[model samples]
Target: MSDRHFSHEVWLSKLRDHLTEERYAARTSRQCIAVARHFLRCLDKQKVDVSTAQPASVEAYLQQTRRMYRRRHGHPTDYKGWQCLHTNGIHMLLRLVQGLWPPAPKAVTPVEILQSEMRGEYAQWMAGQRGLAPGTVSHRCCEAGRLLDWLGERATREELATLTHLDVDGYLKYRAAAVGRRSLKDVTTKIRSFLRWLYMTERTSRDLSSTVIAPMLYAFESIPSALRSGDVEKILAATRQDCTQKGIRDYAILMLISKYGIRSGEIATLRLDDVDWRQEVIRIRHSKTGAISYLPLLPEVGEAVLKYLQDSRPKTSFREIFIRACAPYRPFRCGSSLYRLVRHRLEAANVITTGKRGPHAFRHARAVSMLRATVSVKDIGDLLGHRAADSTLVYLKLATEDLRAVALEIPTGVKA
Candidate 1:
């Protein structure tokens, strides 16, 4: 291939023909041809062989072209300058010579390193010993892997043995700046847990878990970001407009979360067998609490699920109730997809969501409604599959209507 050579005229002709075949506009084809000729001329002036030209050589030519324009105009080149055109044209020209251009490098992630170097040993430990859910294990391992990478820098895992509280502090501070308060809390908890595990297994020499102190939270440091009942209605109405198969699946998921307060992961893990049509009950397996609970299947929710199963849900060997609504039909690969589905529906309905815009908004809304209806904390906890009774306390702060009842009154002429 390197032995092959073409004259400047022949090269431009070939580029012109290729661009023409690609259905480029006549003006675009002319511009590309002009740029290609100028690029070849630049290479000739630099005494670089066109067949052996590297990407750097092409970039160098573009820089030189930019300098010439700047020198002539006595100003820096703008984005719409000739250098940008030459850059695009050179790429188009390089396609004719397959080996002239190199492929972009792939990025290596910390999670990939953890999987490859350690075979996710920590993840397995967390799952097996701590009885954590698979999702939790993945999240913990990812955060731990990132912390190790940040501490190690160019060094390897051998640095884990020498990890100090200072290193933990630096990493947590960096994470806090990048994430919000709630997310930072999760980061602090995961990292501290990771360090404790490392010490227990003799992976690290010191236990730095006690040193990692995140912000303390009262009962309701953050408000429950529940969607208003009107917004929920709008979202449901929007789903009715999308008459596609995907629309049906989304509506079913929305109903399950909004009506039953089921978590996204629970919706993903739902199976056909879990829905007892005769008994009119839907069984939910809560990964967070490791509990199985049954809730009454509402008529609307049941109908939506049935319609989705009959229309949108693909026929696959997977037993999961919900499958991808698109081609290569399979069960949802991640629980986050369910959250994104809710977000898309809300956006379509023109509902302006402010904070924590995910499927959990519906969960919070359900709890708030239950509280407004004078439901007991224990009943709300059971409804939402809360493992601890204390988990229900957060909803108490979200009962604005009840709080309004206990407000102190002021006399009409009490102003001093």
Candidate 2:
């Protein structure tokens, strides 16, 4: 492509589209593109082709520009402050240019390369054979990669098979210090499962899965972080007050979690077709349990969703109901985005919180509310889409009213 094709007007338009696809806000994109345009003009004057532009050339240009500005101002302020502006603009411009003429893949470390290969194979096996969800497979693959990194990068397949209790013990010790108890449990589980797979596939001579002991977890050990009904109301009210496109979308999401007790992943995966307006029900496809169920779409929730879809939702071919509220208008890459949305709203509403900060808090609150209303445990389980009653048992810890009712009364002024 001719360097002239990367002129001021053409480059800015392309950069705008690229930023839109990346989900940047319009104002921010324009500002970045303006800076990028200036940088490109400088390059054009220097008879430099952007495609062949190196980082050193960009850095040198940035330094020269700073010196000129510094000379005019004679100010002792940090130069890095404005230098960052050029750096960011150059980064965005180069990124756009590089995409058109893609660069060669960066060289990978031996350990990373080996881990990548193992992770790919393990992910395929988990998905195809075990019928694991993509999220689960991805997490397990990450753990497997971490384990391989712990083992030497140069270790051979034969050496891997020779892993003993001592190696496993050391890995667990190092991991435990690095993570919380819950995270440690997950690491141990993934390690054990990976070792089992290796042995079953004949990569190992001995079964080492049995050697990795998991941390024992007691039932109802942790307190359920259920928000008070008033706090839940506060969060909903905060969303309602914003009256912005993003607020509308957030209101609809909060309504789903609070009313139906659905998981964040379920909300992220929900599509336009999932809501049956004629039947006034919403179908949930649970990612964890892989179960499909429907619930009555409460009028408030329905209205919130309808308002968002009709007004705030972007025009897109994507079937998913929730998309990033900015351009290029794509669905969320992961469920964590939903958690951040809830956290932001919670902070805005000044709601007191502890432990969990995600949509699961709303799920717990839903269960506790149901229990207070004397709803059957089985019905609460059904509402939460719990495949087993045991899964619903955790909410019992938060059933303070029920516990208060069963407590023995003490005589007035009596001391223990």
Candidate 3:
């Protein structure tokens, strides 16, 4: 707070360089610098502390700008454009100051500091002692922190000796009101794990994990979202007919999942060198399990991919085979991007699929197809990069016809 004065020239110069580096147009850069300079000058005139300036000041300035615009141009159709420039300029300066949208940081208390330390220690235990994946550890640690935050002082190591099942019950009930049955199951499991860890570490007197009851959810209660082979055919056919760059790319992507059962994550992270054309095989590096599996580059999938690479794929130096068709072209960010692409393709093709509509729907469809083909469970599991038998068994829920064929009729003597 001591250095309350903002040197307008110094900050404006920095903002100018930043805007130029970000490729903002010359006029836009000037507008942005002008707004930032105006904000700094306002702070000096009002003797506002730079560290503690309120966001309300930004809104006040914007309101003043709006009035000035009306007086100068009388609410022209394009006045909204100027308004956006003002908003962006103010936000840019604020973000540069705090490294966030908010002007001030929340003052951390002793209890908050303790809570953070506890979460970090728990994360270390989960990662080191349990060998959980990074994503799993982060999620469990976050869930534990949520409980600590909800209980406040009561959740401290010194105070947790008095903790009981009542607190766990209340927390579960509170969370159940917000999330669905399926997501609530994950919450309950994560909360239970935290409670068990706390008791084992001697932070809590009682192990209240068992009391954190989840909602009623039967194992494999719902079948996997499997688009029928015919529906998959329809989607691919629709994309093939379009014959655009995007359509070719979509067809190639669809073939990978529908024919080979490739996971979205694997597709996103697949590198250019992973594909061996001479060997007629593609290497899959699994992130979740750290297992690498090589799959045959089937003629159909390979041909589609070749067409995309030769014609439709962006000319980026990125090693990934697929790239975003738009500017700032880059490989797909993650599995979610793949999900959106598949969903859009499905909707565009007017293919109304059951259960999951994302790329995984085709994966499930492929699994069911293999099962029906009398392919060994081992082969199906290998193709899907499944790490456990239970993971592969989930798709059996979708193999209704096969299940019916193998059904053992109920004995007449055992019937009620």
Best-fitting candidate, scored by TM-score: 2
Instruction: Please give, for residues 315-386, the per-residue lDDT of candidate 3 as tens digits.
Output: 767899888876446899997898888988999899986578998899899999998998888889888888
Tell me how far the alpha carbon of residue 282 in candidate 3 is from the true structure, in angstroms, after superposition: 0.8
Clashing pairs in 1: none
For each of the candidates, give the backbone clash count.
0, 2, 0
Clashes of 2: 2
Model 2 whole-model lDDT (C-alpha atoms): 0.84
Clashing pairs in 3: none
Stretches > 4 Å off in candidate 2: 1-13, 16-29, 34-115, 128-131, 200-205, 409-416
Query: What TM-score fits each model?
Result: 0.66, 0.80, 0.77
- Over 1-416, each residue of candidate 2 has an lDDT whose tens digit, in order, gives 56485465676788787787776777777778877877776778787878787766686687677777779888643766776756765787787777632354342876566557777788899999999888789898888877777886534576877878888888899899999888899899999889888888777779888889778888879878989899999999988999999999999999999998898989999999999999999999987778899888889999999999999999888999998897668899777778889999999999879778889899999999998898988999988888889888889889887898899999899998
**RMSD in Å for model 1:** 9.5
